[model samples]
Target chain A: MTAVLDRAAPAPTPLRRDRRRWVWGLAAVGLVGWALVASGLFSGPVLNPAGSGQFGRFAAAALRPELDPGFLRVLADSALVTVAYAVLGAGLAVVGGALGALAVARTTWGRRRTGWLVARGVVAVPRGLHEAVWGLLLVNVLGLDPWVGVLAIAIPFAAVTATVFAGILDEVPRAAYTALLAAGAGRTTAALYGLLPLATGRLLSYAFYRLECAVRSAVVLGLIGAGGLGYQLALSFASLRWEQVWTTVYALAALCLLADLGGRTVRHRVAEPRPGAGRDRVLSGAVLAVVALTAWAGWYLALSPATLWSVRAREQLDYVLSAAWPPSTEGPLLREVLGAAVDTVLMSVLAIAFATAGAVALAGVAACPHRAGPARRAVGGVVRAVLLLLRAVPPPVWALVLLFVMLPGILPGALALGVYTLGVLGRLVGEAVEEADRRPRETLLAAGATSAGAWLYGTAPALVGPVLALAAYRWEVAVRDAVLVGLLGAGGIGVVLSAATSSFDWPAVTTVLTAIVALSLCIDLLADRARAALR
Target chain B: MAVGERVAVVGASGAGKSTLLGVLDGTVPPTAGHVEVHGTDPAGLRGRALRRLRARTGTVRQHLDLPGPLRVVHNVNAGRLGSWSAARAAWSLLAPQGTAEVRAALDRVGLADRVHERTDRLSGGQRQRVAVARLLVQRPELVLADEPASALDPALADVVLELLGSLAVAGGGALVAALHDPALALRHCDRVVGLEHGRVVLDAPAASLGVTALEGFYGVSR
Candidate 1:
């Protein structure tokens, strides 16, 4: 009986091998199909209002972007609105996130049943919906004003910020917090004097990062006709005025870059150790000025209760839902919508693949410690700067730029989305590499290996699993971004949804939105699977 | 080779016996006092230089300090890290350098059979012998042990102390070990020094260190 069982087990060896090969083959096919779709090889009917013959003319118009005097004025106004929205939104997010983080952080709030459960639920609900979805909901309730955009961005951003803040707080040494508690300090006092002080440096850095993201989201709020660069881009695209679209996109990109630089400067200044009274006074003065300006801007932007609870708000919300609910799934649109959904998934996969490759290359260089000479350090700094720049510019702006240079196709959209994803994934990968256990690398260094060699042998193996997990997570993020990029007329499910919404085809809009939600959930599931496999 | 070259560590509670041993082994650097081992100033060395200085000294901690996740043979081979190339050191993690050397070291410390076992699975006494095996592999010019036998039984502590003394004598390497028991220090070490409140109270040959000297070190009448 034992001999028979052994023979039977051996018989399944080739069969198991074949099954594994088949799964790999299926994965490869899916990947190749995605690549082809991203490269715009799939043919379909053009949804363009203009004839296909006029494609060249549109392309030409995009090349010489119009910068007339009136155009500059609009650009300035949009830029101001964008900055105000970002600042106000980020301010609210910080306050809300701080409160929420305090509630969730075990060091501050004892892990009681009701409070912990409520705080966790709050964190879970807001972050589950995308910022765009928040924007849509707020626009319905608060009209198309800038305050609606601010609330929309702030709500989701605050939830994400709270989670990250709590994570940072958890890393603070437990001994310090415990000592404060033992000394009869209350939860609030412990948070203020013990945990918060220890975590302030890291929290400030993370806040700046979120500020960068908020600026990008602020631009997207324009898609709902909230009077920003996105609104102007949408108008220009509708009228086939490619030059105006390009100019608006350029202005948006510039604002993003400026915000990126300003955030970096602020982070550096706040992080510096101001030893003397003079330096302390200067820092304190700056903090006061920032607070005053932020308050003034929030009031100016009309983020007050009166604006959010106006009588007309109810009617507008009803109108929006009446136009969007009970999705239409019939007619020739069904096939077209399904095809666009597949295209969106393909774009996400391809973009993630490209970003992963870029991140690995850059992280290898950036993970080197400062001991690698000034030149290497300088190069690493440059790589980090480039990453920040890439991340700072929103995917929509990148889509506009690529759309102008490349032929109007899915390839441009994929490339734009990929570049944006690279910035995010690269930073995460570099951090993981930097934070890995240093002992093995030290061992390698002690044994006469060069710095690079040590990293390759010791750090790379330790970090690869985490890096892959990060990349997979970014893939899910890229899927959402890819849909947004499609709103720039790059041919995906988002383009279909944008067309439907513009035409007031509420049923069609609902169908497309449902598909997007489903697609995103699937991507999230896949990312989770990848992470589990690596673990 | 030289009589005074062999070190003798003695101290009462909180007198920093471990701290002195750490400084000698190039681990806990001294804040005020200068340290020179074999006419080389270790304080000025940084990066690679510090690593090189550390390689010439063998250190055994009171808690074993073995990589608990690793095998005994691999932990022993960590002593050869400074001597091997990076590639060789990494490869030694998989296939250790000269099983014969490891075997001989283990045999010398009476742990020849436990060489393939996990370091955490060993008993307190066996783990101390493994630490001795590492010291045997290092073969440094000086060995600094911080209360190496404090956690072991009296009989096992004696055996470990005797083995350390014999190894130092055989290699002509300087040996400095902290001990709470004056009897063990006198029985195994050539000289004994007693410290009280970070200050030396008694410095004398092992034979001369009697009950009165111990009483002075502990600030008690005996």
Candidate 2:
């Protein structure tokens, strides 16, 4: 191989492997092994055999969930609370993101690279931490106020939405904007007319996508003691009420399905806007519905601006700021933070690897091919529904439940995150599969290739690029979610942060938070590099 | 058409040239007439029997439906999927099998240097040649091509036609092509069949017809 490279020859070689992909593949395998070893899989037993009974109870409960009328009423109320938080949070994020996009957009920065870099850095801080972490921190300042849930979801989601929005803005054809400028329009006026019109469809599409995500985030926030379905779930789970837990899971899954269906419809409508119409009725109806929902959510949550600036809120904020100004650099804490960060990265790697593998395997069946036989379509529908349920249940819930069967270690957390990530990645990969060109597969089939062989030679190749891209995107997400599962002593920096926060160790908490932000930033950069290499 | 004969099917855009090719390849069945290839009625064949028959009949479709993200070697090797076991076919994607064979096929098509390049990165003409290279490796007893040289220059088109014709001759099989170029068709084929509105209006030896006769089939006065 070295000799071939030294020659730098363009001559036809005997099927030389892609060296870059080989290196990446080897590195991934090595990292997975190292992570497994670090997780102590080989050193001792990881499974808790005695807990099998408990696991069985949880599994059995799925077949017969709690159906008490009073319990059902509580669940319905909690579901409303969850929806309120999600609507308000996503709505707030969109408003904030739209404004922040202007600040971060390349058109606004122009040639000022440093200014753009700094603005990006500022957004990264908020985006780095998971929503649950924001919930924990907000609870300290806001106490039991409803603002805790909304702010927790909005803060991080706003940062993410802003980054995506800015990218969308930058990708629009700049020719229109520059022409507007050349025609004597002011920069603001020019961007408003030229860029905004071009990006509106994509931006609105993305906002709806965020709303679906916000629904999930709000549930995770509830697990951390904010008021929602997850709060009820957490309570039932603590009492070993398996039936109630199953009930909550079902409700959450139904809610997720609703959001998914709604978001998909709006995204499709936005992508293919009705031609020569005054306005699409579906689009108009969707927008109007969202506005009405947001208003109702605000009223239902009893959100008040005065609560944000109340005296107690100010005093707690000042105290926390003062205590957290000089972050702890104690030797043991720093060492612990470093160790936990490594565990976090490894857990995320294992999770992503597992998710990617599962997603790829399921993508073919999960995608409902238009011309498929009835049985295949039925299988696809079931697979898609299973995926929805997998993602509907939060990672923390998965971690806790999985711990019942498996011993408390990194494996359970990794698997929990893996399953959740698979739910998300599978749908994404399936969509890619659905959208793939069908001609190649048909061509191969016509050439007498077996169905499986044809797919391998044709459909699979087209999907490799997209599947990897989606996996890379999901890997970054899995890292943030590792914290959620880790909060239950699953393994990662989240454990450390939870400990610090419980002890009211503000300085230590601040240090761990910073470390998390820094770790996420590094992973984001690494994932970007990996994606570019794959491309 | 006799074994080892080369036939060119020519007509206007919607003269059902593609549909005829499709029927020959067993994708579209003939509605009114009976058809047989390699002494077997493809419409009645099922499973392994159908696949075995199909493996002997190779086609270069008009769309050149090759997976673009795959390496050129893999795309060329795809021609062997019908004969190879599924496991071998899959493993070949990771570690290509019969490289020398693939290389030789590509070399004949003047694309040997692009053996490791992604198929999508190639130009339209190069991709067409790659498609031709795929059929070369398949070693089908019956060859089918539709506008195989549509993207190529006159010289390259001639070269491709010669390769397809020679491959058919080597296997003692007939070559059937739907061509647009009257001169190329008249030069390379032994027989010419002209169709308009799905009806065969003209069928004669290529040697008996001039380019002007074929051009007339295309509604071209010049």
Candidate 3:
């Protein structure tokens, strides 16, 4: 019952003591920095502009969204384009990811020396950058068009998908692969016959999930004038038309919800029993529909073969590179950029903490089926709904609304990023908790411990590794969001990037872009180490 | 004083016997029912008391429950989790100490030189032995095993049960094991308790547990 009694036996060796101290020191520094930022001692700007009449105008415009047939048509066109972009991007991503996965998979590369290490490094670098950043770079090189968005989503999504696919390939019963090899089957044949069948269901499920995510990224790409719902939303915001913004927001939300529902349904059906021994008709039908619709929509968006060779495309590409490379080193601008970078890091840390804590609490509730009564179930349902709502509302929109309510600083950005990450990490945490072996928790429970107590002792240790992994992943995501939030004037590197872009200061833009990439790489490295440690 | 203890657990297929082991280890809480160990309610035990109880309890399950990535020696030393600090457990994973004790436990279980090898590379029987070594390190006064020999060949099962019996006797630990093989239980245990429908149907000394008794317990007369 006493704390001292519960204190784990002392460290058996001096080496462990040093490692413990180092870990604690790193955590302490992060905590202290977060505390200082949260305390509001370094307030940067007045983000919320009152008496601007922007809200009223936005409200008036949104109220009559249903009346604007022209805008509705625009929305419909944008939605179709969004779907097309996601499908194309996902298709490319799947192909690229599969190839990349083979290159990285231990089964394929474990036998080779140099190729294996190079493949691992390549996988690491691409996965380190966010989809949005990838989009930014691609749009600059390819031009502000659908291809830009498609390539942007494809690159990072492929990297992540490849990593996941490699894991699945590794998990394939080695027995099957080995047997095939023993029978004189080639690596490709073994992979096709042995690994493919086992991994098909999982790979499809992951691809479907990525399709949902790509839809969201496509909307973000639209913010950069790539022509989608996000672009429309951005235009509405810039013009201070709240009503149009609401209408566009609602459309995007509906699209996300539909995708989420459809993906879930497909995933469930794929996992369930087959009616007959025939091919899955439902899967084939859905894939065909998606492909046909994407192709048609791409044609309608004027993303034709000729578009690729257009002078406008070339100019846009030139504009993007001119702004993104060779960043400026001007004195005052450099100070602002540095300050923003610090703020962005602070925002990411705080948001990740909030998400981790929230996820831990909710995951426990969601994991227990029996304890969740009607009321508890209802509350859980509400929490899940809130998470869906937050996820559907892009961080930019969340920031837009929060900027109206709170003073412009890291707080609003942090809150928005935290809400977004909560949706992600909470779902992951709940799944992790549910999937963990229940024997330990049941043991404590049978011994007369309460549910919470059982979870604290039994379930917590097993989940610590997974939960830490989820948190580290979320930290990577939050860093990317931190930059986007900076665009809302919540003083971060994003704000500097936005300002430079607005002023046509290509040198400054290049410098800020480099810093952002460097920061992202650093966070990625830390996350990789943390994941390894937990594993 | 040792109060007579009666425990019955019943569930359909996949009701989770392995989960029950976790309850004994202070890992999983029971949905309903009272479980007291040694007349002390482990339910009320918090941080220290719970840790102490967990440290002092020996548990084995159907599958090899050793941390597969770790060396066999470290897996065995996990039994000493109660006695060792968290730091020690982690360090021991990297470079295990108390080599002689670990070697002795392994040798007793028929795996003398595989101590430094990774547990994942071991066969099912070898892995089970490593787990037995862990139970030896725990040195608990009571043992709870969940279908411990279900995955093993009959010969290996006999070896595992023999090791469990000797370890329990040496530590003066009361052993509670769920066994599918009635003959093995009779051979290895001093007492046998039969559970069929989540309630104990028969409880008797090992010598008294015959085929008729088991058939009656299972509702099938052979």
Candidate 4:
């Protein structure tokens, strides 16, 4: 009825409708580009002097992963440094996040609206930009020290952690908190004893999950000469030694897989542990791991409060801030910044659109049952491995690598991000597929429904909501990443920010940073609403 | 005082039926009275000892609180979680812990093939049976259930109560259940205990209880 009434009313011009259709078509094309980039089968879009020949060689090198013992040993050292930094960074982030969460929790601090707004603003600044960008900014001040590496991961991570932690804390059963408060317990005590325990497991799991992200960030931070497997990879990539890069990549992948596995084990164990030596053993192992990793990280990085407050460091930071103050509101600057922001937003949408599409297509294959045809099984394994690599390498790394074969445009940056997002979205979509109730599909098949028919009628219904939620989440991430990818010369606000930073144009950098921060928070809020609607 | 004494406790929603069974299984404190199960006073048992007491007495509750995310085999294995060492217990989650025992328990409940399936996908009745299978794996000296059949239809309820009766009777242990239906109690139980407003109003052999007796005990007339 609505469509018929609209058609009968003052109709949109055919030209306007065609333009709308064209925009969707471009998104569809971007989605296709996502697949081509993932599969390494598209080349014309990029002015690749190396092209597919080089891309294929690089892709094949991943298959025949360099297993040289000497180099593998070096890779292992880099891996340790990566894990150590991530553990330390994520640990500190948890502490900082917890305090932020407490400060911002509406339940306890709802009366202080100004404080809450200020806290939120503080959290968004770090979380709105990618960790590598933070790394670059830190390098200018901290310079060649492991503290640079550690703080690079810790700062933005802490910000993201604070936001997520606050959200989780806000969700804890308020009845208990209120009950304790009513019973005359202080608000802080009530929160600690009543609410914190309730949300701690979730907080821990999220922290562990962030460890996986931190590992990725730690490597990307390496691109700015911060120490880790990523630093080593950056060095090797710069020299065009794909073989050594693969070794480092393999090491990095192992670290990620280990972190992922350990995280899952701890989450499950802590979520429900029974009386026995089993729980005791697991708990102790976890404590041992955390203590050892954090200690080693701190010791290795030589983290001290002394250096942070050093006159030189403080003076440099002050100088940078002074230079950037009263963010230039000039009309021309505004136009330039606005244009960059638009490019960033469009790039993110394209990246996320393509990533979700690619993920949806491959999810069926990735989640195929082992009982399926052997050929299908092999294809599934290969696809899953590619996805693992895609996710395992940070988005910035993908952007940097793509820059070699592709033109320095948002397209390459978007493609790189799409590939990275594919790894994440593919797993999410696949898990949703795997977790769906198989009984309906089975019944359909048993009743002589074709496999495709059963999937369409039974499985598809359950997947729609979760896939949408994942897409929303990926979009928020892609937006933040779009700015970061500008570091790789991807056309976006990051380029503007990067150009300004290199030339000591602090005012421009500050303006661009403010814009990026605002854009990301808005995107994040929109995505949060989308997820809330799912509930 | 034979081992398999089929005792039925009848009560309204808040008549302390669950608390009574919980005391016997060492899950709740009596506060005023001492209780014994298999000659062991459970009032003072703590830590491992309390867990052991619980592991020995398989008490099914009205709410089937099985973790739905785990496989049927894992849910069943939860019955013996207290008995297994920590390593075996944790490792069991990775791989099926004692597959034969898990399969046998599932077989008794007619869910042999579903041992590897996630428990949440099962129907309401199937989930209740999975709890029963967990009780079977527990191999308790006494079985205590508080209104386990409240969620099932009449016929399914009868079948489940009868299965519980036999699972207890065959082992020469005891089956004590809190029930809503007076008929199931009179038909399946040897002794019936009815409580009204947290106090026992009637205790008699099920064979001697009639419709009038139950109605009077419940303070209802028909």
Top candidate (TM-score): 2
lDDT of each: 0.72, 0.91, 0.71, 0.75
Query: Which of the predicted structures, 1 or 4, would earn the higher TM-score when compared with the native?
Result: 4
* Listed models, DockQ each: 0.05, 0.51, 0.07, 0.01
Candidate 4 interface RMSD (Å): 23.2
Error of 3 at A518 (Å): 2.3
Give Cα distance to truth, residue B76, candidate 2, Å.
1.6
Worst 10 residues of 4 chain A by lDDT: A8-17
Query: What does candidate 2's lDDT look like per residue over A1-535, in tens digits?
Result: 1232234334774556678877877887899899889777899998889999999989999999999999999999999999999999999999999999889988889999999999999999999999999999999999998999999999999999999999999999989899999999999999999999999999999999999999999899899889899999999999999999999999999999999999999999999987894988998899899999999999999989999999999999999999997999999999999999999989999999899999989988899888689999899999999999999999888999888888877899999999999999999999898899998888778889999899999898888877887888888899999987887679899999999999999999999999999999998998887788678
Q: What tier of docking accuracy does candidate 2 attain? A: medium
Candidate 1 residue lDDT tens string, A1-535: 1232123211111101234435644774688576765575566531444444455676577568998999889888777777777778887898899878877876556657687777776676666556666676576567667777888889988988888898899888878777888999986787678887888878877777777777888888776566667677778877877788668766766777776676776677777866665555544664566577678767766666676566687777778788777789797788888889888777777778788889988887766674588888888889987786677557776776565446666677887888988888888888787777765555434333445545544466566567777877787788877877776577788788778766868788778777776777677777777677654
Between 2 and 3, whose TM-score is larger?
2
Predicted candidate 3 versus true structure: per-residue lDDT over A5-108, tens digit per residue: 23443322222223643584488367747745663847655445683465556556655664488989988988887888888888789889998998898888
- For DockQ, the strongest prediction is 2
Measured against the true structure, the TM-scores of the candidates, in listed sequence, are 0.62, 0.96, 0.69, 0.65
lDDT string, candidate 1, B158-213, tens digits: 77777677677676667888887767777778777676676776677777777556
Instruction: Kindly indicate the candidate among 1 and 3 with the higher TM-score.
Output: 3
* Candidate 3, residue B217: how far the Cα is off, in Å: 10
How big is the positional error of residue A205 in model 3, measured in Å on the Cα after superposition?
Answer: 3.2
Give one digit per residue, the lDDT tens place, for model 4 in A1-535.
Answer: 1232123223211211224435544654665466445433354455677676777777677667667798778777877788778888888887887777766666646878888888778777888878877877887776666777778778888887877888899898889888999999997899888998899778878887888778777777776677778888888788877888788887777777787788888778778866665445876678688878898888876778788888988888888889889788888988999988877877787778778889999999899773599998899889888888888887777887787677676678778889999999998898888778775444323222335544543466567667878998888988888887887677888888888888988887788888988998898897777666543
Off by over 4 Å in 3: A1-32, A38-77, A96-144, A158-199, A235-250, A267-276, A315-336, A366-368, B1-222
For the predicted complex of model 1, DockQ is: 0.05
lDDT tens per residue, model 4, B168-204: 8887788999987788888889999887677887788
For candidate 2, give the lDDT of residue A159: 95
